[model samples]
Target: MATRPIRMFGDPVLRTRAQEVTEFDAALEHLIDDMLETMDEAGGVGLAANQVGVTKRVFVYDCSHIEEGLRGHIVNPVWEAIGEETQIDQEGCLSIPGVQKDTERFQTVKVSGQDKDGNPVSMVASGLMARCIQHETDHLDGILFLKRLSPELRKEAMAELRNAEWNQEPRG
Candidate 1:
């Protein structure tokens, strides 16, 4: 599988909600494989299709450092916050690089989606796994971690994004 060039911030595909995957075919498989390779090469915990300039509702994650990390691609995922408990921690994204800001996220989450092969898949995870899952789900919905920041933090994040030279580079 080839490592796809990650789309930077301001890319329209990242802002547009990815279309649900209806065909579980060879192309989908290839995309997932490429995404996994890209994520690994980029040293990111997760990578979404939109981050790689594909508007398909799919993401690949690997949070093996956590005990119950959910590692694999989820197609057309539906995620929910599991409890009232929350954790505030620094969060970063592959698309929006050079910025890590404090973000609040549910400590536990439940996600259900199809696998690369169109098989049913579900998982309940906490800690880094949960955070990664939620982060990636947000990408599929045309949302970024920057949107989750508070007003002041969001403003600061916007400024940081604007000042990043890489953000102005042409999409490869």
Candidate 2:
């Protein structure tokens, strides 16, 4: 597996909704491996297909470190909240590069999707793991965490965003 280039925030592809994967073929499996490598290299908990310039409803995540031994991928995934929305947490994205912002998300979530082998799987996640899932899945739908930010905060972040460097190598 090799790390794939991540599409930056301003890329038009990042704003376009991803297409669902209909055929679980070799190429799809390859993409999943590449995505896992990419996410690992970038030190991200989750990554979406759109973030890698593939417009597909595919995302990979490994929250095992967060929840201890619970980790996997989500291809053509769909998610729903388990309860009422919860407080805001500061979230960051690999697509947005160095930028980070606060956003509100459900504290618990139930997601359904296929595994790398195309086997159907469903699981519930909560806390930071849940937030990460929501954030990454949103990217597949062309949604950014900044979209969930407060108007005032978003306005303030714009200036910083303008000055932010998108192509900078991740800090060690």
Candidate 3:
């Protein structure tokens, strides 16, 4: 599988809500494969369709820390907060590279979706995995982690993003 160039933070596609995947076919499979390769190449735990310039409601993640064999793609995903408990953790995104900030997220979550083949997928996650699922899900909804930061933090992040080399439009 070939690695696709990740769409940077300034790309408009990264802010567009992804379309749900209605057909499970060869193209879908190929996109998933390429996403996995791209995520691996970038050393990120999760990668969203928008991050790769595909406005499909899909994301691939490798959260082996939560479950030893847990790693796969979620298509048309829907997630819910599992409890009132929340945690603030530092997060970095593949689209908005070189920036990490503290963001609040649910301590546990239950996410369900279909696989690349249209098979049903479900999982209850916590810790890093839960955070990852939430992070990638935001991408599908056209929300960036930077937007989740506090007002002061978001302003700081915006300044940094403006001066970041990877923030250039027409992603390389």
- Candidate number achieving the greatest lDDT relative to the actual structure: 3
Write candidate 1's Cα lDDT for 1-172 as tens digits: 9999999888888898999999999999999999999999999999999999999999999987565445688999998989789999999999989999999999999999999888999988888888888898899889999999999999999999888988676778
Q: In model 3, which runs have C-alpha deviations exceeding 4 angstroms? A: 168-172
The sequence of per-residue lDDT tens digits that candidate 3 reaches over residues 67-112 is 7977889999999999889989999998888889999999999999
Backbone clash numbers for all candidates listed:
0, 0, 0
lDDT of all predictions, in order shown?
A: 0.91, 0.85, 0.92
Q: Arrange candidates, best TM-score first.
A: 3, 1, 2
Ranking by lDDT: 3, 1, 2
TM-score per model over all chains: 0.94, 0.92, 0.95
Listed per candidate, the RMSD to the true structure in angstroms reads 2.5, 3.6, 2.4
